[model samples]
Target: MSADEHITQRNSSVSGNDTKGSTEYQTGGIHDFKTQPNESCSFTTLKSNTDEEAAIPLMVGDVHLAEAQELWSTVRDKAVKLRMDRSGLGSQPPMTVHQMFMATVQKFGEYPALRVKKDRTWVTLTYNEYYQHSRAAAKSFMKLGLERFHSVGILGFNSPEWFIADVGCILAGGLSTGIYTTNSPEACQYVADDCKANVLVVENNKQLTKILQVRDQLSYLKAIVQYKGELEQKLANVYTWAEFMKLGENVPDAKLDALINSQSANECCTLIYTSGTTGSPKGVMLSHDNITWTASAAGHMIKLKMAEEEVVSYLPLSHVAAQINDMWISMRIAGVTSFAEPDALKGSLGNTLREVRPTRFLGVPRVWEKMQEAMKAVGKNSSVMKRIISDWAKVIGLQASYNTMNGVSSAPWGFTLANILVFNNVRKALGLDRCRACYTGAAPITKDTLEYFMSLYIPIFELYGMSESTGPHTMSWAEGHRIMSCGKVLNGCKTKIDKPDADGNGEICFWGRHVFMGYLNMPEKTENALDADAWLHSGDLGKHDKDDFLFITGRIKELIITAGGENVPPIPIENALKEKVSIISNVMLVGDKKKFLSMLVTLKCNADDNGDPTDDLTPQVVEFCQQCGVVASKVSEVINKKEPAIYKAIQEGIDHVNAKATSNVQRVQKWTILPQDFSISGGELGPTMKLKRPVVNKMYQEEINKFYSE
Candidate 1:
């Protein structure tokens, strides 16, 4: 055979003898443990200075000099390493998604790879079957003339088919773009057109209807493949998944082998669109090298165990956070991933958690907040004895969490008793008994919420990253974490604060192999995001302590500047206010060029009926009013009337927050409660439950104006 054909043949089969360091598992499959390159493929390793002792300079601005220096004095000599080396993990990183997938299949072929709900039962896909099915899908794409470097769009909720289609496109040497399932048709059209995707795969008839609405505008769209449901309208260029897979039966494996073998690590593999809080979403181009390096680095930071970990897939696949944790990192670690039912996530996530008992779980701040709220409700309704025990356990847990955050190992005898009496049951009830690591990111989580979970013996780590950095750049690891800190930079990543203000807060900039290639077809925007030296300007204001833990203050553009010219970061104040007052669902501080700071607040309303607030309020809402000694049929009435009792409570909450404020500009001068809460469907909140500041400000402009006028 010719050299090219030899390479193609070697890549096609799972024969152990052909590849170096290939081990034959007892389960009757070949697993390659070494990071060997195919004859036609090459890989790149990120450069690092592992052995050098770099100076730990205090990068503090004038405003933070005293505090920074004081913190620095404690850990200047014994601080944990800020930048860990990937090489120190004792393994060569896989270069491409295909490489990682093949290695995982080789290592755990008979092990369950994916589990999905089928009617009333769960269906499992083993590693061997996953690889074979992906190959089949790739063959089908090749039959459809999917050329190398072309783009394919996947629009759907988290499902096993989504994972199959994504890997199929990558294995076929085409880049895949995921469109948010909750996005409007116009938004979907923008992503499909901007990426120039030739084929779009959607979940069901509803998703297909979205494509049909905008199909006329998609010039490059050649075909639409539906993973579920039959052909309803019989539109042109629409194919059912069964039909698509049948198309692959005629195509040979050699074609896919050659395609996979020709791939390079430096090439772009995926385009993840931003959430578009500021403007239209930008397509972030991420190379295979970026994903692989991030997976390896993050795995090292969190110490993910291979074949011993499981994770639930519920977060939108369009988001990079889910992609990294559920797809890339899982593949790298050869771990199992279970898909949550599409329509049942909100009602069944807790049940699913108990069923899966995932060792690693990733949740946004909202999910954690809901869990905390549920715990609070349970505590409220429990008997006096249970409440006392819970409170006592919480006190012990809080102390234990504090010690853990400060890197101290000792715990009092009461802590062990509390763990057995209350904390352990709490963990089991939340289905986090087996969870080794729980992470919250995508937005800032309140310190109160973090400590609440910690008191339950479940430490929730805060991670920081964006689409431009392959999901996570900094994360609070298990060994060394601090309250309110996003932890140190990940292994193989470098972070710096640029143009710090007097308060030492500045735009958080990062440089590493994990940085994205650039925004798709938007060179000017990409240039604005990345500087000449390749440091990504994150557009987030943050500060770092002497121990190298990162603390995000707020968004640079969202900072509220008072008429007196004092700049106030709203996030900390908003978080503090929410922590103090449980009823305030969302808060947006306003005072840009105004005399004083004011806020537009929204109340948390849980009606007994989903659509009828007048019918009855939830027990928790009623209990809150009763505890405060306010008599009202609806929580909205108290807020709308600004009733003296509730108003006094709110004012006391605000005053308490102001007491902790460092300056008068940071204090809330006034606030007005909205009739309803911010929600994703209402456009006030992003898909991840992050408040869209611009949208919210415009929405309550009239209410905000009234506050200033009064």
Candidate 2:
């Protein structure tokens, strides 16, 4: 087969490294950047020398820091201007999702589209290639007689077909459903039955088996299309991916036109089944316009213009976060967005990364925390070579933290010396040297994690948003982030405080075109979410400074109501604890409707940064506990001493919160603080990382009862 023939013919605009013409732009599998040629033209590397700050005088080149920043600045200005212009178009004006996607693709067609490389061989489906795939997939869906509002399911991890299936469904006027790869027989059955999809696309044997198990339960499924090699797990009545493409290639062009003509901007494009925090998952219906406009607005903030550059995408499709960054942004901006190859996210991430050299990467805070932990692990390890690397990393971290904190990202000559001596090897190993910017959301990340990334020259700016808002609200686009705030509101997005506690923080309501039309069949929910004035009642408490940067405090429902009717934001205390110590993982403030403010503490620190506690831990964890002035229990020396510093802070916070309240609201009683960390898999926190209070209180009924009981 010819080199081009080896490439997967999926959406061209969807992948980040799919350029026109093969030039070793693809790889066979993970750990093979040494083989592929870059599709994007050579942008000069940013240079580094010893004057910046380093143990050894080292010179590093090809990063192109100033050039990258300049490009981003121009894009940012354009995004802001376009958003302001569109702001006048009204909150609910309509346009097709396909139109938004195509417009962007036309703009960035020359850039590499999608880069998927494994082991040795690599394939990039460029913008033109991606476009061909979408057109064909849409045509095939039309030939299959799918009607608008009908449902189609795509089940797998991040991949090219994931977007192909999604776009095909939407372009054919059908609603798309995404299933988590981790779904069990019952979960698969539940989603299939609930969404009532007519066609389902499976990645391979594992996900296909899930469909097979629930085949009896699904009444609406008429077609099961497989995207895998068909080498594993036999199945019947299934259309191979190649056959599906053939159907499209053979279809008359007139029918393809009809498919596009049939689609409406305001119609439901995707039925995103939210990974529910409570109860069974519900399908959050987002219109093409809802998501398209959302992408339009969000794209502007991150400068996701359909420019000639690469963006890395490895987020899960089941959630709104990935859908927006990977699909919606690609659809609206028109650039090559790469997917992390299969289950080999970390490995594939490194390989594909070298191939694509993406400018922007949208990640969850957990990923950032993991990166930070990995660095610290390497730095603090006993290995002689690792320790040497760690010493250099400490220098890089210090410089990065200083720059990120001061917002002076331009490096002096000293930091230049450090990069060559230290940061280059780390950057190459992490495959992050090519990254221009990284946006982290979904949950709160330690400032340390953010600084650690920025120090390595990958600025991982954090943001906050929700599914109802179509994605982000407050995003840290620029440098100099206040230690307290998430970042400023994106351009054209507005915020207001409904009611503030003694602190300026209140339920953060948003007003913008990005806010969705409303909840799909639940009118009451729709009404509650979109208030009379059209401002989205975000239900999240936050405060913004004069500069418009937003600082999220806590959830309104989550505000721990003290015994004296004193309202307290638990997140501040929880977050403050995270910044202050190492051994503590999660700290939940209790004492709502109780005499005094108490907290339940969960331990096992490395869940985010460190892997399993059994596999790895810092020796300093024990020593750091002592330095923080925490003492192990007089009764049990084994208990982590770090627990008390957090416990003491919670007690002190009670006093701080009470100072603003009346006499009745003053805090005065005992506090119960435990020594265990809450977990998501173990059912301590929700997937979004919020404390499952009932779970915490139930599991530690003894600890909780000690303070409140007579």
Candidate 3:
């Protein structure tokens, strides 16, 4: 029998007796639903008999044989559309991360696999070189006595070596755990100790310093491997990149291949730590099957063409989005993955984008926002004719965007003209002319921001998922784009709304092969996230449209209940306020169990031409402040004091927004100007730039109380 046939036969036996009422079959805590045996086999489902008469007895509960067959056919069609071929006729079944890497190397050994910037020079690595170097690293790990299921911590910015080290650990039959480069020593130690990592990989001396600070706390850590920079201290078990690779020179490739073959899809491959917006970070265990499935499904969704697709890797590799896009998906499709210079990304991502002109770009909302700001800054100084042309082009582009979002087939003549004369140039200037697909996730993006990019002929698909869901549960597919929705659920994934309210908003739940295994060493949390029925409760409140597109409203835990017994979703209101007020940096709606809603607002400061902080406020900036009734002479003063002018300006802005509120309880009754903006360093914003509401509420309890007291 073929491998696929054998897998089906094995699953049929493991499925046990067909329980009449059971909706799912449990095997080692993972549920596999029953499908028609003739249909393509899925790792997520069990095959049944194809004969109509014989299959009748296998139907669950009231499901008729015909109905079951029809349901299976529908699912099979969706999988086929997603290019998920389990029979391996046209496409191969999902492979583990290590297997995928090796397969890519075998097929595209001479093709450029990775590009990195080193001291103003671009360095390229072929698929073969990447494979050889990673194998060497894996051998070195084995030489260091690292065995199967052992954990290794990778802490650094995105780099080519980072990918090598990550895949090396997997090839050695070990779990790779990523630590955010921005994490403090305490946070680093927590992750390393919790995962019981035996080896720690650091990028440079700075990262090495963090490890040294918490070295004594990580009793399980045996070795430190530095990929860059000279070691400052002669500590035991310390090995530089050159030294580490040297340890594996005598080791055989057969040894690494044996270890890779020993790994199973069901075993844990990587431990991704959650951003911990609410509390301490928990290691989310994602099995090889979970990752490979996600990579395959997501790659299919985007329709990435092999050898032609390119992506810039800049986001924290610790984040699942970056890991999946830059690491897994790139490997899955044999695409080029470029590593942006860490320091350059903060101030000059545009330059890097121009240099790479990547075909596929994935960024968070902040990146899009910064690009918009830069464009606006240029427009502010442009000639009158240019401004007029730009504005007219945007009007045409907006109509086209609106038509696309509503599923219209044809665009007006003006859209074509604008695309040729204005939008196309704008795209080229932003280095997005070659970009075929652009995505934004990790946090909520405002509709205004999404539309703005859409107007520039760059459609930004807003996706929704968490660390527990591998990467993406729902994404705006190019064929059926939606303006504000998170698009339809991916193939092989099932979604349902639990306890929907009057507006049809409810906690979003998911059941699929891409759902993570569990939280490491946190069974209680895992049990809470994954129920007995196998549905993963997302804790996020959302509503699905008539077309089945999902729209996330807000976090269930962040929902505010007023003293007047009115429930308010703060995200929409906050998003609206941000759209209306440009100078507002951040706004937090606060009124939980209170008589009325209020907010804490922060102001954006003006910067000089060199992007340095400046005390001088431009005429436009001063005019905006004045329009809101603020009387600050300098931009810096807006955050320096609680002046009457600032309060009046804030109140004016609030009153303007309140006029559009649907209910009295949703309107802001009071407001305050925070002395500073919420930041990641301050513990008010998560790594993804999402506001940590609980942390913010606790830090400003006294200020919040004063607002309520009045």
Candidate 4:
């Protein structure tokens, strides 16, 4: 989050273990993408990824292409100015996000743009291929009445077509409304209607089903374009992705090029929906200028404008963070952006990583935590292995940080050997072996998990932001990344703790150019979140340090005040228990309006890698019963009935969970270790991994009973 997060690139005359002019340290550590194998170097043919990105709005200009270019120049200048200030290094004059994308298309055209593995090979799109795809798709959308600033519905996972669809929509001068891929039929119906979309670019059969269910409800829907080939189930007004491409193929190239020429940088680009934590989601309208402002704040402190730099796009695009960073940010600079291949998440996660070898990656805490859990699972059985891994992790992290800061790769030869032998496995597991830098946001992440990863020589920066505030507000670590806090305030973004509690924490309020114009229809909600001064009250509680380091404490709405006047911020404790205990997955801190705060802990599903023979978790439950001195009968009773077991589990897990707690704040006086974990496919966790507290609390009224009786 630091404006000065300048990672030094490795220059010649430096080995993986050489220092700067002296033997002490280099100016900074370098990301060794230079040493990674080319896309073709992999065992199979390079191909495209299947993970669908949230739709990007395409543009078509019947007027003012030249003016758009000027706007691009203005925004580009802003980006360059901020980028230079942050890195303390100069950058080539920055282009508008649009101008940047044009440059990137030319540089890495031959490299894999997005890819997926199938049958034994990688299916991918190089930059040239992606450009062709987008242009053709744009032409097709043009045939469907595409015009500047018209809205379209986009529902899918992260993929090249998603990008292509977005670009096509934009190239044809249309805005896109991105809906969550997992949204239910009703929610999907709600979003499509809310956006007033005329066309919907869908991913596959599942997405099509949701639309099909409410096809009649969407009176404005004129066309449905399927990006994933033909649909297995027929639906009204549906067009296959290939047929649409062919429609664009015959369209005059001069006409298509002319459309591209007319784009305006200030045009309304995308209607991004923020996932509602307390209320129904609202559309956050972002323009080329709005997006340009958001990305420019980081400038090149996070990444310099490098044409050949590869970025992997995997996070939910509906959200502003990933949409701006992965698609808009990368395209603005014309860097090679790859999507994870395969609809299957776990499969694509590992394989796509090795193939893409991206220079920048952005993800939420859940994704990062999963990577950490994966590493711990690989080494948990051996204490000696864990210790060595931990020590080497811290050293390599600092070494990488120091070397990166100094612009050197001077890891001691001894350290490099250990890294290769011990740390590489961990890095490879997270598919981060080729990563340059990463940051987790959308929620607060634990210092322990982050610090654990930092040791692996991967510089994972923690950032805090919101959908309302354009995205990032404050970033921690002026120099060395802070594991405990989101970084200091971004350049040009003013942040202050509006009010503090006894602990010096308050809701973080942010005022910036990146802040929203207002909610589309919900003026009251908009007014509450945005103040008179235009600072977006994040609705998140956090505290700041004397040095101005901002540590996000918890969500203001989620704090549970007990009868005794103790306020429990659930997320920190829930985050603390995540993966620390193999049995627990989703945890909710309850006990509000009660004598003391307690917890309701949910167990994770221990599925096999292939999920062929699903893991039978009875033994683990039995062991938990033994560990906590709770009877297996009581555990079984509470497990089956979500309501019935809360009290016993709360009381029992609390006693046992305490042995692991470091302080009174974390110690659970009572808790119910649930029968099962909140699943990804399940709606228990919002897409962002923040708990749906009200839903969970409602589902287990009886289980919370055990603590009340005592």
RMSD of each: 12.0, 14.3, 8.6, 11.6
Looking at candidate 3, the ten consecutive residues that score lowest on lDDT are 69-78
List model 1 lDDT by residue over 1-710, tens digit each.
11111112211111111222211111111212232222232333322235332211111111000111110011111111011122422123335678777767776799998998888698999999999989999888888877676778999888888998999999998888999887899999999988778889999999999999999999988889999989887878799999888878988778789888766555677889987877889888887767876887787677677688899999888999999999988877778999887743355789888888899889999899878888898898899999998998888888888888777889966998898889778878878889898999998899889989888878898899998899998888788688889887876566767777666777888756677777777768877887654457899988887777888988878888888888788998898899998777778889999999998877666632222223234466667778778776575677666778767777888999999999877889888877777777678877677888989888888998898887
lDDT of 2 by residue, 546-589 (tens): 65567776787777787677777676566555555554556766
lDDT of 4 by residue, 144-191 (tens): 776555667889887777888887776666676788887888888888
Whose lDDT is higher: candidate 3's or candidate 4's? 3
Which whole-number lDDT from 0 to 100 does residue 557 have in model 1? 89
**Looking at model 1, which ten-residue stretch has the lowest summed lDDT?**
63-72
In TM-score terms, candidate 2 sits at 0.74
Against the reference, the lDDT scores of all candidates come to 0.75, 0.59, 0.73, 0.60
TM-score, each model? Answer: 0.86, 0.74, 0.86, 0.75
Off by over 4 Å in 2: 1-94, 104-110, 143-145, 229-236, 243-251, 304-306, 343-356, 382-426, 451-459, 479-481, 596-600, 605-680, 683-710
Candidate 2, number of clashes: 47
How do the residues 504-617 of candidate 3 rate in per-residue lDDT, one tens digit apiece?
Answer: 877888755577777877768877887654457898988888878888988878899999888898988888888887767678999999998889886665444443335555
Instruction: Report the Cα lDDT for candidate 4.
Output: 0.60
The alpha-carbon lDDT assigned to residue 368 of candidate 2 equals: 66
Best by lDDT: 1
lDDT of 1 at 89: 24
After best superposition, candidate 2 residue 549: deviation in angstroms?
Answer: 0.9
